[model samples]
Target: MIQSTTPGKMDRLAAFIEVFKLRIAVVSTPHASSPGSPALLLAGSEDEGNARVVFRLHGFSEVPDDVRVVAEVNFDNEANPLMSALPDEISVPLGGSVALQATAMAFLSEAAEGRCGRSAALNRLAEVLMLMVLRSAIDSGAQQPGLLAGLAHASLHRALVSIHEMPAHPWTVDDLAASAAMSRSAFMSSFRTTVGMTPMAYLGAWRLTLARRHLKAGEAVKLTARRAGFGSAAAFSRAFSRAYGHAPADLKRAGASAL
Candidate 1:
């Protein structure tokens, strides 16, 4: 479920998390992770190139290779707007921070517990830890302008969230500026500087992204177009082809062929 948006206290990561359809599995203690295992220690997933993301663990064996938390993270890196905002592979160092060590150990304890709702509990814990790592990345700011840089900005994030929450809406620069409580020109310039794209470009990209997801899921062309902010299926197909180099109907045909 998408978390209810709170005024002034919103969860910026909520939308992306929903797209991930996150799954978690904890490799409890006594199973020592390989010390040189970089792939298992990173908090990212592989791009499996399908609607479903393969189960990829957020490797937590960074320090001392204690325990690893397996997670099916966001694999649709191209479609996910904020994927570039994070480091491709992140492994937070717990050796330097006592608080971080406590946080990591707490989750391990929960993994060890044989209680009711253990799986859900462990998933939630891993989500929190992963969020901490992503939050650190967001807080550190970005050298290149993109979703991370825009999200790190004080005002731009609000506007970005507006676009994210309502992709189907016909968003104008004025509308988005009002959402951010900024002048149209200021919003435009700042957004370009921070996100490296015009607002409309971002909106179009977001719409096509949603459209691609629908197509990949085998949704009808007209319905997908309508739901993804296109005026008609033809328009959607044109834009989708320009972006992804294939027609929307092609995915359906592929799925049909497979079936």
Candidate 2:
């Protein structure tokens, strides 16, 4: 079920660079254990900075004490290099059972339309919030900033960018090495050292992530495989199963895939 690994896999992820166009949404609710329900406020929109941050407020009537989120969990590009280096979850407490929730998404039309589309205030707000969360996390000693700092290396960063920009291209160590202006040996060693995996292995992981998204969208297994750079769905399924512990069609059926 193994397909030949190539640089094309990274191209799929490159599309996410436009995340600034998304909007941030916030929802506030009271905790159940509180004696009195708290007031709630939710606000969001599509605009730079606005879309990157979301503000939610909750009020408690009787409780004099408050719970607070002293630290945040950030996941901005400037923060980390690992594509999926995120904590399982983060919690922020509001005094007196008040809660603030933040979420973000790009306008459907803008996202589907193309780049150069209008960026939403909500998107900017979301970005800001993300940055804040990560900063908070680092400040609170909840996570290691060193992990993210290390990912900012120039060669690895450029390699990541190249993969995201051209996922469909057939890529090799030689090609990537040329792109990074490094000898093949140096590139291979550096990439493995930084990412903790071989270049081909990273490519395979990227392809699988893309194929899973397409499958969940009900695009059909064969089409998903081809688009993700596999020659056939059978090959995709085999690779998917090996990597994720499930068949490609199973992802389609579950409908729990991420794009």
Candidate 3:
């Protein structure tokens, strides 16, 4: 369930926490990274040598696409400490945390048993482990201009929550500034500095992202347009094409083809 602390009202840290939903995929040696996915690496000593686990996070699916963009902008085909750019082959030391060790063992046990009732329990463990990784990254002061930077800034967090919570709302720079309790000029500069995009630009990207999801879910174009805050189907189509390099109908067809 998406947290319901009322978007613009939550404290910065709480707001940040609400934006993640744990998604996990475990692989043995030689893990492959999924594009646009953030992950946590867990590694520890094994009987023979060492063991590793990859917890692939689809958490960004819960965040606005614009926010994801901020977190991912620096990502490239190179090694980086930032989670989004984390190398596929890196083995993160499972820092001697007993609680984490217990949780990891439990997850492995559940996976081996393949019990239906244990899925939720495993998911909760994955969420906890992911948080542990994120906390370590933040505590280490891994400076990457994205979600971490936005979360660190009180004002930017407020604006980000508003955007995430109400992508359908007709948000303007002035309104977002009011939400952040800052002057228009300060809000613009600070948002760009921390989030790497102007408020309106972020909103536009976010809305289009929502529209894409809706379309993929088989929502009609006109309804998707309205729900995504577009003035009309044509406008939404133009913007969607600009953002994603394809028309909504094309995406719908592609989704159908996949099935």
Best-matching candidate per TM-score: 1
Whole-model Cα lDDT of every candidate shown, in order = 0.65, 0.47, 0.58
TM-score of 2: 0.53
Worst 10 residues of 3 by lDDT: 66-75
lDDT per residue (tens digit) for residues 144-237 in model 2? 3322322345455456556655555677888877766778999888777766677677777767766665776677888888888876778888
Shift of residue 175 alpha carbon in model 3, Å: 1.4
Model 3 residue 231 distance off true place after TM-score fit, in angstroms: 1.8
TM-score of each: 0.74, 0.53, 0.63
Q: Which stretches of candidate 2 lie over 4 Å from their true place?
A: 1-14, 17-23, 29-83, 87-124, 129-151, 255-259
1-259, model 3: which lDDT tens digit per residue? Answer: 1333665444433323433323454433223434455544444444433444433333223332211011122211122213442222222344346666676677667756878877666556666666565554443332555655765565676776677667778888899998889999999998887767788887887677567666766788999999989889999999999877888988776664432
lDDT of 2: 0.47
Which 10 consecutive residues of model 1 have the lowest summed lDDT?
48-57
The C-alpha stretches of model 1 lying farther than 4 A from their native spots are: 1-9, 27-78, 89-103, 112-120, 256-259
Question: TM-score-based ranking, best first?
Answer: 1, 3, 2
Q: By how many angstroms RMSD does model 1 differ from the true structure?
A: 7.8
Candidate number achieving the greatest lDDT relative to the actual structure: 1
